[model samples]
Target: MPLAVGPYGQSQPSCFVKMGFVMGCAVGMAAGALFGTFSCLRIGMRSRELMGGIGKTMMQSGGTFSTYMAIGMDIRC
Candidate 1:
């Protein structure tokens, strides 16, 4: 007996679609779990350094802002 093909000339069963969906969900969940763990560790380790760097950046920004304000005041006078 000859096999019948669908419109695309391929005979794919419904099981294949269900299996693919289940596998996709499993893979996505696994990846999300791994990434969440990694992100937690990454942030925990860098939190102190991040705060220090932010403080330094704020100081530098303040100095630059004061300089620009002075320049504007001089231009106005």
Candidate 2:
């Protein structure tokens, strides 16, 4: 197969494409984790105001579990 010419008519290596793909995935993972953390904090606050200590703890645990699951999807992603 012939190499594709880049914008400046130079041969472009596919490694840059691979690097960009990896970077995109890392950014996506970080965004998901950050959003999950924010959601967990919000849910924790609400649960604390509406329930007892045990209930609050349970909510926090659930939130953490979900966040972990999302972050753990890196390989699948």
Candidate 3:
């Protein structure tokens, strides 16, 4: 059951989409942070570059994850 109808017959499909997006974003950001840190270190990035690289990596990963997650959950529903 993807949805639970209310007494008034309202369907709230956004709930599942939101849930997937939030969860995926969190997971992706964490993974990105870990991998980005190691990658930047391996590349011998200075402190300034390290922070910027990590931030960029995190945003890219988060967006990718969230988009796929939202679409997947929507399809599952």
- State in Å the error of residue 74, model 1: 1.7
Give lDDT tens digits, candidate 3, residues 1-77. Answer: 45767789997657888899988899889889999999989999988999999999998898899889988988987
TM-score of 3: 0.80
lDDT of 1 by residue, 40-75 (tens): 456673676655544454444444544454454445
TM-score of 2: 0.37
Q: Count the backbone clashes (under 3 Å) in each candidate.
A: 0, 0, 0
Look at candidate 1 and tell me the lDDT of residue 41: 57
* Between candidates 1 and 2, the TM-score winner: 1
Whose lDDT is greatest here? 3
Off by over 4 Å in 1: 1-45
Residue pairs with colliding backbones in model 1 are: none
Ten contiguous residues minimizing lDDT sum, candidate 3: 1-10
Model 2 clash count equals 0
Winning candidate number (TM-score)? 3
